[model samples]
Target: MTKLMIVEDDEKIRDELRLFFERYGYVVACATQFDHVVDEVLSAKPDILLLDINLPYYDGFYICRSIRKQSKMGIIIVTSRNAEMDELMSMNLGADDFVTKPFNTQILLARVASLAGRVRQDGVQTSVLNYGNFSLDANKMLLICGERSCELSKNEYRIAACLLRERGKIVTREQLMDDLWNNHQFLDDNTLTVNVNRLRRKMSEIHAEPSIQTKRGVGYRL
Candidate 1:
């Protein structure tokens, strides 16, 4: 069964959603304390997250960004904010999907199921890899942080994925260049630097600094 985490603060809505999802064969865990949301999320390690924009203490975006630091799980923002900017911002923050308030329960269920399926399919190779506020999907080349996600280009994905897989461990620059380029022996060093910068920018977009710390004389580490 797919496990889901519900991060809504409204007691009535949370209960309804929990009951509704449970009926759909999902194992649902609803947040009881806003302050401990992160701890709860890490412990639950849910397959998908149902987030409300208006959360207690810290807003949903902060929580999403925080989780994005180390999880590639599906994230769906179900909120009352209906503005286009709100939707855009949610996506930018790392949400896989956005459903406004007063949504159809069936539709919400369907979206959750769809996302859950994708996450499961991709889970085969992407068992785990963590960055600051982002996680890399080794199989899908997907960069996820909170409600925002960015699809990585082949080289970009490989480089970032490599760093994340060996997070906290150094990966030499030469090794990274070779891994990313494969048989391409003529790839420029400057080109590698450029790709790294672009990947760094993408990571920073969702509030995660590049966990890719340079060793100056060595390589990079997440």
Candidate 2:
């Protein structure tokens, strides 16, 4: 079943959304705490996130940016802030879509369904990827090797996922950066190198076999 997470502070609206989405057959999870909204959403590992802009501790923009750093989960900003700049900022922070306040529940449902469909089309709906002895848990951001396991950060998980998808084939640096940042023009090459190094360290800690191999100027291989 497709999972949905809601991060709205308004109790009445949150309950309404949860109930409405559940009626549509979605396994819904609601945020009970506002200060750790990002962690809450990540833990839920929902297929789609319905986020509100005016959160309690941190705004939705901050939450969106934090979530984008680790996962490419679909995020739709459902907020009362209807200004054009607000929408633009939400998109800039990696929100998949934006819906204004007083939104029609049906419309919200349609948007969630559309975003979830896009995620499926991207071939990321699966929660796990198995490569040889390694099992990458997309939901938990964990890489398991036999009995030992190591948790991965969002960037590390993406890098591992990309490499594992192609297995022994070479994955160029440019391809990795594009995959990680969604072709953000301002991204630095060093960031990709750092993430790859971190991933290598994690894999090593678990003694994962068929280690990530650097192909010098060409790219990396597993």
Once fitted onto the true fold, the runs of candidate 1 whose alpha carbons sit more than 4 angstroms away are 120-222
lDDT by residue for model 2 (174-205), tens: 88878877734333688888888999988889
lDDT of model 1, residue 26: 67
lDDT of 1 by residue, 68-175 (tens): 777888899999999999889888888899999999987787677557545632344224344345556656777877678888888788787666545556888888
TM-score of each: 0.55, 0.56
Q: Which ten contiguous residues of candidate 1 have the minimum total lDDT? A: 120-129
Worst 10 residues of 2 by lDDT: 114-123
Highest lDDT: give the candidate number: 2
Give candidate 1's TM-score: 0.55
Candidate 2 local distance difference test against the native: 0.82
Error of 2 at 222 (Å): 44
